[model samples]
Target: MDPLNNMLTILDAEMGAPSRIEKTGSWAVRFDEYQQFRIGAVLRGDIWLRVDGGAPRRLSEGDCYLLGDGKPHVIGSDLTAPASDGDAETAETGGLETARSAAADPAAISSVVLTGSLGLDQATEPLLRSRIPGYVEMKSSSYRSQVARPILELLSRENAWEIPDADLMRLHLSRILLIQLVRTALRTADGCAAAPPDRLLTRMDERIRCALDLIHRQPSKRWTVANLAAAAHMSRSVFAARFRTAVGMPPLEYLEMWRIRSAAAVLQSTDRTVSSVAAQFGYSADSTFSRAFKRVTGRAPKQYRQLAA
Candidate 1:
């Protein structure tokens, strides 16, 4: 049983099934509250996004933006343009302030922005942050041609009630979008190099994936670096070096993080006591688990459970 493998499995399970399509306005449609990752795809016409004192960025047709945290932001034709003074007072129709006051009405707009909100957690935020610029415009390009266009078309036709498979489709599309964005970011980060060309780092990714799979599959097992390295088919020294390069952390540190995260979910979602939860993740004692949990989360397990509950 590997703790890292357990963590990944939990991530997969805890990531909620994406919710119903929400019509926000003439210009915006969002996913249900269950989603932590939100994506807004623009179709037909343009939309503007105003983020907390930042200049508004206009999104044209076939353009998309991902909001990692689903924070309250303004999206409309003119994010900078002020609304009618009259509509400014009503809470719902009160203009820019009101846009964040409640979810936008999707039926009110013609051009659409597809929003896929996935509840903003650490695992998911990196995927969104690495790709989206403060504002990036995708012009006529093969990437956009192959990906964004199809997603926009599907979003345009599918109604919340008419489409039974909408949620699954959205999830799949989001995954595709994330992968494409990651590839693009990696390319840029690597200066357009065709490959990372670092054999050690490449091997490290494979090893980390193996380690991650082990932890996700069986979190209850007491895991160690020696065991994890063997799983990667490398000696500890080589495996550790490669894992650090690929994942930016040592294997044991990654395992600890995985354990703490797993314990957190159980603590939050179940009535299991701290001791039981700690033991579930292979902690020999509650005190040790508490210390580790506090170090990672800035709160003891008991405190976290209370707050989460």
Candidate 2:
């Protein structure tokens, strides 16, 4: 496969589908933690989105926002309104459930936000994940999201009904649109105009590419800095520095990060025991892996599992 395709494929694996996809009305999650990759499309009406204390920005119908790094953001009908939580209200356009504020004015919220949780938190594959972006907002009219707009429309239409086939179609189309959206967003990055964004995978420093591939393709392997350097055909010092410059982290650190991220996905999506999950990732003792996991993820394996659950 071509380099761009290869990178896209890797990113596809990293992000997967939008977990816990939902369409909500007048939404605002006050304590925003950008822990999960989020792709949101304004399926109906208009909403205001603000991130990291920035000014509120308007997202009209057909706009999509991607948060790969999970930068916290708030979206609602009115940004200044107090955070409200109530039973989900049925959407007029889509059969999706939307949260309605319990207030005297029933028509207070007119926006239906289709939110998809992109689980990048579960996959820290350094090569593609770190290189792209953590936060990006593109309008349907922008050069970046031209194709994304149509895909979003299809998703909006698919979500509008309760057909049995609509579920599968919505799931698959959401995944496709996400990959396409990420690709377009990366193209707007620096030096992207001169080269295909995926060239980062194919056109990387030869040695660094070798190391990155080794780590991502074999996260189960017990790898060391020495092994990665040898794979890159560089001296230890040169390899470490070059790897940092190219991939944004030391070789060994990347391995641990990838392992922990994999562990998170497994823990969140499965009923696997901590010991078994740790062992699967090459940790000899559950405690050793627990410390490593906690160091990287801020929660113990069991605790993280509970949170995921």
Candidate 3:
């Protein structure tokens, strides 16, 4: 199975309530650090989006982007306009207010944006944050031709509050849309022959992906550096270096983390004893597993299960 697909499958992801913003003429809003992933799509007109003081990027209708890095950013129709703090405006309006230019015609809405937060449970957040860049954008023409367009249409309906079961529908649609965005970003990166190696998810090295697949496929297996390297058809030293660079951790560390994380899922879903769960994931002793589990999850297995329950 594809490693990207596997990561999305195992991640405990949730979509926050989506909001729509309609604006006319020049306006800019500065949003403080989100510290979590954010996703947005332009429904109509144009937008200027800049993250952490980076160069401004224009997003036209049908375009969407994901922000994985926790940094302050700005989005507006006019980049030079004095930006008002988004939180302050939201508090004053109880949410993002519909903006219009003074004396502008009521029908002259120049921009409409659909936005929301993508939340990942603590156990799986690091796995993705390490692999994806701070930002990924999917152009209008590119995404509109793929599976994303239909989902975006559904999301637009949610934004309009025109559909039944609005909350439930929005949640599922947002999740699917986020997945499509990542998939498109990955494919776009993969197709770019001139893309650099440092772009992790975009130009993910096939060999490293193979190693990740092996780990996810069999978290219970006693995967050593030597064997994982051999499986990837690389020398042990080279494989270790490459995996660390691409994945942000040494091979064995990733294996242990994955094993513990898998065990945490079982703890919440099943009735197995802690010791049995530990052994099943290659932890020969309960104490050994408990320490590792606490290191990754900040709670003992039993305590974690209790909290989750």
Q: What is each predicted model's overall lDDT from 0 to 1?
A: 0.53, 0.63, 0.73
Q: After superposition, which runs of candidate 3 have C-alpha atoms over 4 Å from their true positions? A: 14-24, 31-35, 42-46, 50-63, 69-73, 85-177, 187-202, 233-235
CA lDDT, candidate 1, residue 200: 18
Per-residue lDDT tens digits for candidate 2, residues 1-309, read: 444453444232222222112234545544356555667667567777777756778888777777665556666776777654321222122333334444524444456555654543333345556655666677756654666656655665666665778755765565576666656555645524635555546646887877877776777888988888888899999999988877667778777877787677788778978888898888999889999999988989998887555
Q: State the lDDT at 180 in candidate 3.
A: 71
User: Candidate 1 on 75-187: residue-level lDDT in tens?
Assistant: 66644444332112222221112222135545554454444333323432332343234333343344643585565445434423356675556545544555444344334
Predicted model with the maximum lDDT: 3
TM-score of 3: 0.65
Candidate number of the best TM-score: 3
Steric clash count of candidate 1: 32
Pick by TM-score: 1 or 3, better one? 3
Q: Residue 40's C-alpha lDDT in candidate 2?
A: 69
lDDT of 3 by residue, 118-179 (tens): 78755446557776678888777773334564565565556556455766676566567766
lDDT measured at residue 230 in model 3 versus the true structure, 0 to 100 = 93
